[model samples]
Target: MHSPDSLYQQLQKIGTSPALTVYGEDRIELSGKVLANHIAKIANFLVDEVELEPGSRVVLDLPLHWKTFAWALAALVAGGNVVVGREKIADAEPGTVVVTSRPHGIELDSGDTVVALPLGSLALSWAGELDPGVYDGAADVMSFPDSLLFSGLGDESNASFYANAVPHVPQGRIGLVSPSVIEAISVGYSTLSSGNSLVIVGATSTADSIFATEHAESFTPPVRI
Candidate 1:
């Protein structure tokens, strides 16, 4: 009632279902339990914590950092539209609350409300607040092996459909982590559930490359963790 945190749980309860991965056609099949965690995290942070009202446009103005991904997710969690342009694009005008950073400092002019959101720091704070239990694959129920396939849509304009198709992530779960080992979690589950043997190879930023390795490794039973 008073804040977004107040409504966090309520939002998560709404998004639990089978999700389609944006990476490709069948990257990872998720269930309700997994989707609930993501939405809950985002809702708690954006609605309850940041306290942004509905209809506010959050500019995801960070560089190619993991936090930007989280912020984008958080903005959606709070029911806010996102502006991914530079701070100058937002601040050149007036009466705008632009979420910028120290790196690309937006030269503030009169009447410009530049909100410097420390995305990196905020990510740490958010992660610290979460329970350690979550680090152990809060959503993964099993891994995959033989008969596994990997599919993705990617970051192209068409990728927006990924979110639309996959169950909405909880607001609180919309976040970023660099030191956060997502691939390990992903690989572990992929092999175990798919009944495919897996090999832990390095991951490249290229989605196709990463997916290729994951798919190639999923030909047998899982390699030991």
Candidate 2:
């Protein structure tokens, strides 16, 4: 078994199979190589564009979508401490970077940097106008290199979310519908860490059909870490 100390490296080792299949407004499928590239693009954007420093907080105030997972992975790989979900959005500290689907809804201090993401499978950019200082996550990420420009992983002790014990997922195409973004990340991390592919549905109602279509053999949520 390959033991990678970081989430970035763990995902890098995934075999060239369908690493992620998301059923949202559209069906999006990503191979391991493609997923790694997407991750690299966002990580590079976070580091080079956002100027995210190692140990700096990156709060994700997004829904349970595939992009949320990608954003989380990128932040973790770039060594930015990540906070997933909307519960902590308002409390984000000044100078921290916040990635959200609802850029207009939140109230942020001037020192905070906001990256706005559109939650569609085929979205090339944020659908409409963004606040002057906000970063359009979909459009800006397209300009970064496919491989990581900066390649340092966060210290395990400092990354509280991923550093927690992950519940074991089966070693196959696993299907999941998590109650929260944190649980989703935990399941995603464990599935990839175990070198298994994942199929995530945007809503629990679609899980049955999506899982059957993807040939996912096991459905597990496990004890939320």
| True lDDT of residue 204, candidate 1 | 29
Estimate every model's Cα lDDT from 0 to 1.
Answer: 0.34, 0.74
- RMSD versus native structure for model 1: 15.0
Candidate 2 structure quality by residue, lDDT tens digits, 184-214 = 6766776776677788776567678768888
TM-score of each: 0.37, 0.85
TM value for model 2 = 0.85
The positional error of residue 120 in candidate 1, measured at the CA in angstroms, is: 5.4
Residues 102-179 of candidate 1: C-alpha lDDT, one tens digit per residue: 424355445434344444322332222222222111112112121112111011112232223323222211111121
**When superposed on Cα atoms, how far off is each prediction in RMSD?**
15.0, 2.8
Model 1 clashing-pair count: 43
**Model 1: per-residue Cα lDDT at residue 39:** 38
Number of backbone-clashing residue pairs for each candidate, in the order shown: 43, 0
After superposition of all CA atoms, the RMSD between model 2 and the true structure is 2.8
